[model samples]
Target: MSAALPQVFPHAGLPARVTVYEVGARDGLQNEKATVPTAVKAQFIDRLAEAGATVVEATSFVHPKWVPQLADAEDLFTGLRRRDGVRYPVLVPNPRGYERALACGAREIAVFASATETFARRNLNTSVEGALAEIEAVVARARAAGLWVRGYVSMCFGDPWQGPVDPAAVAAVVERLLSAGCQEISLGDTIGTATPGHVRALIDTLGSRGVDPARLAVHFHDTYGQALANTLAALLAGITTVDASAGGLGGCPFAKSATGNLATEDLVWMLDGLGVYTGIDLPALVETSRWMAGHLGRPAPSRAVQALTKD
Candidate 1:
């Protein structure tokens, strides 16, 4: 029997294809309370790729003292049976982390930055300016090594400590990342307080700052059920890349209020209905998520996964 599919209704003004930057491996598993086995992590990445995800964030090289869940970064990255035509980008916190990724033979890497000072202090243990300064050096070195670098700007829409964030402040951080030789930037709604208007406004603000929307991506948390809505706003604003976790399985360990990331299944389902090509096999993706959830000993949080898997 064939799996169920959403009926296609072509949407005007939407891109022909969207790149789903799958973060289930690094971002998703990083927040887990239990340590997932290294082999399981490798299999998870391979399954996501088999399900047609071209850009899967493999793992982070942060110190185990910070994110202990991903302590096996080197082991996992070394044993990964990389697929053809798929890009696995790992997170590198600083120069030392970049060195680890480089030694692991990482071809692509991402650096994290924060827009708000409070969260920067808590998450990165530095001020916003200090974080940018450190990330600038890391990004420059990665680019010099011919590695594709992605910059992640967190707290773009809102911050728990600071409340509503100024879009202009977010743009400043983005401008620095672009200046630092980052190939792309993923704006993070870390607290999930963003509305559709706020999402569009931030992207517009970046555009006015001479940052092209083409070089941007959106990373939304679904704490308030607004991830999909904010994503729609970004898509309409000509942003194509989106960061999502399989089975909706990630939250910021540093930010207690932050919740699970926008689910890959949910995003794919919506894009499928809108006739936006993602090249993903929905049933295969769901099965992969379900498999991972079994390892986590919980049901998948994705609405599409729950509904479609009901017997």
Candidate 2:
């Protein structure tokens, strides 16, 4: 085992450090039952920056009817404090979303699509192929405008309506996203049902398909309480980027019982304890999550950090 990893970590020090993309402001807030005010979003983003999160997803520029919580994407993007070194990525569903993001001075953007045909039709009002065609155009436009593009493949592990996604299907979508010029692609467990074994298998499949492991990211939700285990599996498989939300802010609207994204505070706590350098200030991150939870009239679900700091 390498000196950088704690003894407790499985496959300690094998995969090295990972880049954590913070998505509390966008994906975390998009599914909220109550629309969070723009000011609160800006403050939340500023606090995330103070906690050493470099890649913060700011908001989505989708149609208001689809995700009403992010209806003020334009104002929210412009109102936030734009730091020098940190990146603010906004989700753009189509060419129109990309253009709107551009108008708000967005330098980076994210595009998303579901792997299942049913989800594609329900979520995007189109088929998988149709959604991919739109996303391809969005990617080209964003790249031409000198923007960083991140592709998101939802339901990588499983879907509510579609059970047990095929690894081949996941690989195909990943290939298309990479071919369309997305610098990185994040595979999402939209329903949070992934296990460690499944994570390893999917990564292996993607790797075998000529997908560069370095450009792959894992976005896991903690609904089944297996996110951390799956994250460990991804790290062992050479995935370097992970997506997490601070405070575990969002839940699955499709599956009401599901919780939210893996909390940043919890991930950082584990990484720090394992001697992994995430470049995060644990105390500051916990404070941010606590504050957000309080503001939302709830408690944070970050068991690690909450327990560590509550004393």
lDDT score, candidate 1, position 214: 96
Instruction: Show model 1 residue runs off by greater than 4 Å.
Output: 1-3
**How do the residues 29-58 of candidate 1 rate in per-residue lDDT, one tens digit apiece?**
998989999999999999999999999999
Using all chains and alpha carbons, the TM-scores for the candidates as numbered come to 0.99, 0.94
Tens-digit lDDT track of model 2 for 78-172? 88888878889989988888889888899888999888887888778899999999999889888888889999999888878878899999899
Model 1 TM-score (2 dp): 0.99
lDDT of 2: 0.85
What TM-score, to 2 decimals, does candidate 2 have?
A: 0.94
True-vs-predicted CA distance for residue 204, candidate 2, Å: 0.6
